[model samples]
Target chain A: MKIYFPNFFQALLLIVLFTGGSAAFANEKSFIDEIKGADAPFDNRSVKLVRPVTLETVLAKEEYQGGAFRVLARKQHIERYKCSSCHVPGKPVLVQQGFELTHGDVVINHGRKGNELSCIDCHNQEDRDYLEDKKGRKIDFDHSYQLCGQCHFRQKRDWLGGAHGKRVTNWAGDRVVYNCASCHNPHSPRFEKRFPATYSVPLN
Target chain B: MGFTKKDKAEKIIEDVLEKPSSRRTFLKGASIAMAAGSAALATGCMPSGDDSSSGEMQLRWQEYFKKHYRLMTQKEKDETVDRLERLAKIQDDIDVQIGTEPPIENVLYGYAFNISRCEGFMECVTACVKENNLDRKTNTQYIRIFEMEPGKLDPSTGDGQFYHKVPVENKFYMGVQCFHCENAPCIKACPTKATWREPDGIVVVDYNWCIGCRYCQAACPYFGRRFNWGKGEVPKEELTTKQHYLGNRKRPMGKMEKCTFCIQRTRKGRLPACVDACPTGSRVFGNLLDPDSEIRYVLKHKKVFRMKENIGTQPKFWYFID
Candidate 1:
């Protein structure tokens, strides 16, 4: 009983193999592409469209909360004001001129040996993220501290524990907190001008 | 305030005495100044436009117009230097070292920071903007401090250290700034000699000379320099009238800028803005030349480190863990 496969059966088997191979090849190529230019694309990483959309949907903002529209507004704000006209703006926190962050001596350890963060790595966005309020209304980026706590659980815990950044006591109660930029300059995060030696002069 | 020949001589003598040279040299300069002052007075007719209410009629020096120092037109450069000397209350007859002075050249200064002990108070940022006379309209902030976790390299993962309500706990704030390098890539990247390293290892940018190419911004390994997208927002009423020549001079449109370690203040025996602003005394600054300085002491005794030492910029600034 040597069963000869009909021409149709043979054709169907070929189509199945061809379609499966192509799909597998396509998937492999996508993965390969990701690995090949991974580091290079870091400089040109576009905002994740889906993630922001998802974020807006989850927050259910009456106004679009994805922050996609805010990028140009922020750029315009920077332009109109000329933030770098007097001092350098867009400088990373770690490398602004004439800045230092250590005292007399004795190094403090905060665990930056293997995995340290860059200014953009955390700041990620060029503009501020809009947050959701209790009434499902979109708030300004000024109130986006809660958005930061989403990923920085430890720092958030420390913040809650009274140890990380600024300490703004709520006028209403101790339960409320102010956002990060309240004290920190979001652009150049490091090398602050306010230090003990500069107390005589009024600071920015 | 019109000065006669006698008044001119007296002013010259006073200037010579104020310089750092020896008493003999000072006396010689004084004699020359007196002679020149007398000559101008003898010529008669004080160069009009005397604003007596403003004070003595100060002769604006011609030193700023020297052809070799910069690219300004004959008229522009002359006016600039004249304004400078007048601002400094110098008589035109006095031979100021403005252009004739030898350049200090590069002394190779840079900064290194210890990332562990900083409390993200932002005292430094505020201090710098004020001391440098940064334009407010632009919100020109020079420093960026990241609240980072232990053993982590990415600042993005850290909550910008902003998670702390006002002053948070546990996380260490790491402050980074221009590592004024011995061989600054920013300087090399500039098409003009607008930004250069000073003899004391500080890098300075000439706002007037800058073309706003922004190549230096791209070339800096530490991302130190910044560009002005618009005119800065400094209030006229709040401006610090007292300014240094290369330090915190009023800037113009479409130029690049950055921190200079408060050269005007620092060179005059004062602390940089950031060092003085740290409430925790987290930052310590001093002349590396002085062995007894607090900064030198820290460098010698503590385990100090520069950020990205592998880049080989040889920063003058140092950082230590608390």
Candidate 2:
């Protein structure tokens, strides 16, 4: 006991130094949170008080940059939306003059190079309007990405995480990205080789 | 190899006596002559009248002597931009807008090229030419998409002049542009303090400050810079009216210009023309600081490499394969 604790003031000093220093370090560590992805969802909480963008955040009072972004809706751009318009309820086939003219040319080359799929594989045979997943869950045309995610899950993961696809309009505010169907045709996905376009064409 | 006094005197005499000199020496001599002439003209050269012609002359006078874009304050920038707009209207009958938008905070821009996706369509080249007001007469292109075979990724082994159908079997495409290197040798090579990197990692050249020495062109390992051989003319109607002071604005002949990642567009939160125009979605651009940005995701999840990265250029531009 004597060897361990001779001077009371010295003991107090050591205790104060160790405990106080450790507490400060713990606080700093929690604040910084330098772990792999403490800010994975990227809420901007880890962002310290630095930029003038802080002022914009305070003024806008909204979702921070890179926090809330969405995939652009494809329903409006789709030529044959509300598939119920053509494929009426309980009608096996609408067999109209314009129907074949509009969509008769859609060739199935989607999975020709790999695990081949038929029309009924991804398309719901029961309902012509909706796309079904492997589990037969109906996915809206607007959210066809959900249908795509069912098979191409790797690409889906990257697309959802802000890679593998193009962003539209702007980069900063309300990041809107393109859906898979926007670039790749649902039926024929392969791109053909073509002559490169140029504005000047000076190299002729 | 050191220059002694005798050698220095001989070099100076050679520099002065050389009639048709090198591009660098010519620019230095011309600038000195212009300075002397301007000093003489500074005292009451113009007639004192508010005539429309006098007003035009006054604008020209200020423009000819305007300070470098970097040194100008916000008010000075606005004044210069205004003066330039007026001068374009009066001299060329072209309505133009020159902006001076500064770099945004926390927004370090980066670009990613998907080597697997690019079909060598040259659409980015077309878009860059139109968007950046490139010299149509000379067909000055800022972006070059090279058609390369599968072996080596080096551009020298690739062909940029392919006009045939793209995505030729067993061939891949790579793009080359001003990499906007963090340690840009072009910036160091510039004798005038004209070319410098913006805060957002874009290396920009102040056209007014450039003396047309072409040192930056020779200094770039990627052969990225373009020198204006002559005034590359664009039809007045074909001119892109919206311009940035240090970007796509009409450039006088003999100055240096290169890609600014479409600064006028990118600064406004829009994608660069090349990225937007790519049909294959091969070009990805976004803020490097944002972890959720597509560029950041590519940097994390993709197999990536940079051109001449071993030279310590530290280019923000990266090429990747899925």
Candidate 3:
């Protein structure tokens, strides 16, 4: 009789666990739908035309070498991680089960009170493929500069004017510049302090 | 041997003078005879001291008699380029391209340095050295980055030889090169008109015409010139085969050289090597006539200052703080 009661309770628990998991998944889908329907202020089109005439465009037109603009897509760089492989399409939990994070090597020392900010703050919650702007707009990984420009408007203005950031490829040709993420890691935006190249010897 | 050769040459000149026709013809014939006698004597003495081949000798003579770069006709310039290519092939066994690319119209090059951003990387200095094909033996670097203390405007007090970790406490870096000043004292100092400012505001030196008097060097307040005391030691493998006639085509010993703002690259709408090499985006270069250029923007917005402004050299290069 004792063995029979425990066996009965185990069966009941299994049924409850399966049903609860499926119900939670259904709720998560509905939540994603609700978020998608919400109005986002910024779109890809608006983001692109924010600055009409950048310093790069001006220089590029003057030189006019039939150059094209290019940027590295985030998906290309972060494909190995496979965030969707472990993370389900729903709100993230404080602690995940059956998934051991091996990315401890990534150090985040950016922003005030760095530990308070998490990956989800800048990263999209519903979609792992793109980043999220303050207005909850889905930004492509290639256009992460737009995401960075939200809070760093002054820097963005200077960068647009050619006062900050580095220009890649030919300076006079088509203006293909490196994204902000190319030089500074989004998690840790500050440049690492290191020694520069060797000094030139002076004529004695 | 030298005394007998001189006597024979003199005797030939005397004979030519004695057989005088009209004044003009006699003088011309006499000069021609003297030249032939001297040429024969030189060939005779070749075995003793002259190791150069006859082809090389002819090339050297042509190079010596070549007109100034600015004055050379198109045909003369083409011939000179051919001669230089052949000389490079014969001497170094390397194929070299020497071209004369003129400056673009309505383009006066200007440079702006952001003092706040320069981290004393010295990348620009090395790039300038390699691109300009400067003499490594004499450490002929055209650019100097001065590490100066904050709250100080005196460049004389800055240390150019600091070999420590850069961005030192309370210090900023400022780089100086040939500013190509409008009121250039060096141009005024040249006795033979070997150096002059181009239409594009670049002060260029005709290597063949310079007499190496060092007058320009003395007159430059910014120490913007270098004298080649010995043959420039560029490794055969490291030789930049792409060269410009008045720019980096290997200069001979005893000629004064200064920066031409990378004429070979700039004339083709390409940034100078230093500008491309800078990692910090501290150096800005553009056409001063372009109202929308980065350099023009910096000039209009930033608090720009020029070195030695009191002296009124009117340098095209400007320094600014963002």
Top TM-score prediction, candidate number: 2
Off by over 4 Å in 2: A1-67, A94-101, A113-116, A199-204, B1-52
lDDT, candidate 3, at B295: 64
Root-mean-square deviation per candidate: 27.3, 12.2, 28.5
Q: What is the lDDT of residue A167 in candidate 1?
A: 16
Candidate 1: what lDDT? 0.49
lDDT of 3 at B135: 85
lDDT of 2 by residue, A1-204 (tens): 786676886889999999988865554333113222323443223322211121111111112235555565567776777666766767566457545746777777877567667877887877867888889898777677778777788877767665577777566665667767778888877777788996323231
In candidate 1, what are the lDDT values of residues A1-204, reduced to their tens digit? 246667778899999999988865554344224222223211101211111211111221112111111111122222324323333446443333313432123222222655544433433233323344334444445444444455556554433322333212110011122234444444433434332321111112
Assess each prediction's global lDDT (C-alpha) against the native.
0.49, 0.75, 0.71
What is the alpha-carbon interface RMSD for each candidate? 23.4, 10.0, 21.3
Residues B77-173 of candidate 3: C-alpha lDDT, one tens digit per residue: 9999999998888787889999887766556678888898888888898888888888877888888888899987666788988888777878999
Please give the distance, in angstroms, between residue B88's alpha carbon in candidate 3 and its true position after superposition: 1.1
Candidate 1 stretches greater than 4 Å from native = A1-204, B1-79, B84-114, B153-166
**Higher-ranked by lDDT: 1 or 2:** 2
- In model 1, how large is the Cα lDDT of residue B312? 57
